[model samples]
Target: KLRERLKISGDYHECNETNSSLLLLTENNTSLDLNISRDAVFGNCLDLAVKKFQKRHGLVVDGVVGGGTQRALNMTIEEKIDKVQLNIDRIKWLPREKNERYVIVNVPEFMLHYVEDGEIKQQLAVIVGDRKHPTPIFSENISYIVLNPYWKVPEGIVRREVIPAMVKNPNYLKKQGLEAHQTWDENSPRVDTSWIYWEEYLYGQKKFPYRLMQPPGPKNALGKIKFKFPNKFSVYLHDTPTKHLFKKRVRAFSHGCVRLSQPTDFLKTISTFNPKINMKKATKRLKGKRKQFIKVKNQLRIHLVYLTVGINKEGQVEFRNDIYNYDKYQKRRIR
Candidate 1:
């Protein structure tokens, strides 16, 4: 009955390389007249259309009508209506008061919007957190910017990741330009790697005394800059070395911190709020090898929200997958 109302005609056929070749041809930028065929055999035109639909819907662009794609294609009008209503309720929970300017990161959409006077001033793609390391939804103020930033490896990552890697290869720290410190203090003494027992650290027999830090450089994981905000979660927005990940439709790669696609441009936009922020000097600082923290004159409100369905500027109902399963939880509550 739902499928009949939605007019979902047929199940997506098993994709083949022949159909994928047609998909490649469509991407060639030359127009090819491939007639729409009946047999539900994924043809060049249909495959290309499916890919475009997937791209627009923020799904993985594999050109294959798999489970995820099939589910999206099969969504009934009633389902979309329910999602729209639920998102409306979610919006009501947010503060009704408007700020003069602010930053909003919609997690499911994988995008950030900088707004002023209720108008969008700037927008960019962002990589949010995955399920295992979910990005928290909350409001905070972006207080400062760190140029040529060093990455203070998170304690959880250090325990779960760094120690294991070091156990396999002791040179991992040196090769990655990372250093271990006895304490998180600015002037903490550096720990000599040779004296450390990797197994003791990994096995929890010995406490890892040092905090792992990567010095600011081309290979730095935090890229050239970081936007600081006060949050109990210790999560902040920053640039990343993995810029290629931003091109993907579903960008939930970060542990918790939001990774900006265009950090430089984002910096410039926020810099305008405070007269003290000098973009000239800031850009110059980005060239330096040392990490420098620059406090902005005015703090901008930044909200990390999980809105899977929204009404865009054109007033079209845009939907995205519930990357964090917030929609599923909300649906259960509705029931």
Candidate 2:
């Protein structure tokens, strides 16, 4: 009960009750070979074991039992059992996949697996939505790939961010690589800003009737390309301008859409599946800043899923924090 008395603060060669509990917890894992002293010391062996344990559990391998690491260590057996049972029940609820080629994006895991001929052909890291704007779970076929796609800023974003920014500076649109069109159509001529009182919209006296569109380029929110799977929620997989986020251990930051870490690599993989795709031309178009939409002749399905427990590379069972707290409502049931 040393670990029960207190969580390990973390350091090498420290002899304390916390270290004793930490060692006990690490010893129980059995997956890693600590081989260090079990004599209530946070020795080098225990540090190595802690790193391995953190790596195995998808925690940041800092060798320190920080808040995140402590949370993982503190997970009760009953809670883990509930998660396993919930996932077991969840499997039955999933509609059987009919396609031989499909993509599965497990929301909680923040990972995408491309399966072909019953084998996992490719896997890609992805950044999904946080609790506020949780990613929706649904299945849809990706019909086309849009290169240098324009981002039609959502109405909510326009209302909250764009409108407020524009109220202060009318030139905000031009500065952000955005254009205010008279209509939703791209070809619609740019409206004269001076004529309309932009402040009326800020005051909620008049409905903001202009559509904002960001042109295809490096500044595009959708990045260089996007895999489209049309749905009511308008959610799809796409590249992001901020590529650095993928480096972090925890990557649940997006506005409901799934962000791809290796979008170009995934695109190349897709190119192999469809012979009609011209990778050379796609690359050229990207560099030339010319937008192109390529049709995917081969059928491809994208399933956005919710799972908190999954197997790691070594076939070891791993648990993920339910950031969305979906486990609370997803009561396990059997028919």
Candidate 3:
């Protein structure tokens, strides 16, 4: 009965009516030796039993039994039934269909996957947000991509980081390629660089009377390409000039935006599968000085997701480091 409920097919290796009956008996943590005589049901073919058990539960398929495989096999029929059922439910939580292609960002594992025709074509390590600044999960269409975009300093960033730094050294903004702008109305307090020494303002001893913005260049925080999507959060995926940062296995060093290790490779991959546009020309265009904006020929769906447990190509369930603590939230939701 457990075998039927598990949907274990007769086509599986070493499976039979007799073993099927044993499955029901041993399904609830009951132990049975493979050496049992052929006359006995659910006995013999220990190797085949282990392999089948592993295959069904998304474990490494080694005929030789191990602790993990043993633990899984020993699970009661109800427990085994629930494991499969839960994964099925999890699958439902994912996007079922897409318009031919999409980019998938699994936040928990800190990886990005490109999927086409319901199969993962390419995967790359990604730096997600830390616990304090966890990456948000959402789906959006990639409308257009910007090349060498300018970094617009947000208000919070100016007040928290820039203003204090400027007070210490008048040349701080100059070294960082920042320019000051004064545009407040008459009612607003005036800030005069001539009166308030920049050195004092950098140390928080005085306040600078201006807005600062760093221009676009190699030193600019945003390296090159930036994928644009309409969202309230004003967040977008982009390349970073600090390419060395991607070398680290756990790259969670960003203010808020998602940073890619190999953004050029990603762009090539996305453009290749896209029905319109020549990927070769696009690659060539990036070399030019002029910034380019290419609208996706066919709107591609991009899903920013999080999953601590996932299956690999070998069908083995792999666990990744939970950088964002999303697993606890998911587990709680499931419970």
Q: Each candidate: what lDDT?
A: 0.79, 0.79, 0.63
- For the record, the alpha-carbon RMSD of candidate 2 to the native fold, in angstroms, is 3.4
Score residue 81 of candidate 2 by CA lDDT: 83
Candidate 1 wrong stretches, greater than 4 Å: 1-52, 60-67
Better of 2 and 3 by lDDT: 2
What RMSD, rounded to one decimal, does every model reach? 6.0, 3.4, 11.2
Residue 193 lDDT, candidate 3, scale 0-100: 49
lDDT score of residue 130 within candidate 2: 79
Best by TM-score: 2
Clashing pairs in 1: none
Model 3 Cα lDDT, one tens digit per residue, 33-67: 23434444344464465555565444556653444
Expressed as tens digits, the lDDT of each residue in 1-335 for candidate 2 is: 33444444443222232544465554554544355556524556667776876876678887765666667766777778888888877777887988888999998777899999888999998999978889999889888999988899888788878888888998888788888888888789987766767777875567789888998887888998999988999889999999999988878898899999888888888889899999998888878667788999885888898888877767877777787887877763331
- lDDT per residue (tens digit) for residues 193-305 in model 1: 87888888885667777888988898898999999998899899999989999878889998988999999999999877788888998888888887788897688999898
Model 3 stretches with alpha carbons more than 4 Å out: 1-91, 181-212, 273-285, 330-335
Instruction: List clashing residue pairs in candidate 3.
Output: 27-77, 34-44, 166-202, 167-201, 167-202, 167-203, 168-202, 168-203, 191-209
lDDT of 3: 0.63
Ranking by TM-score: 2, 1, 3
TM-score of 3: 0.63
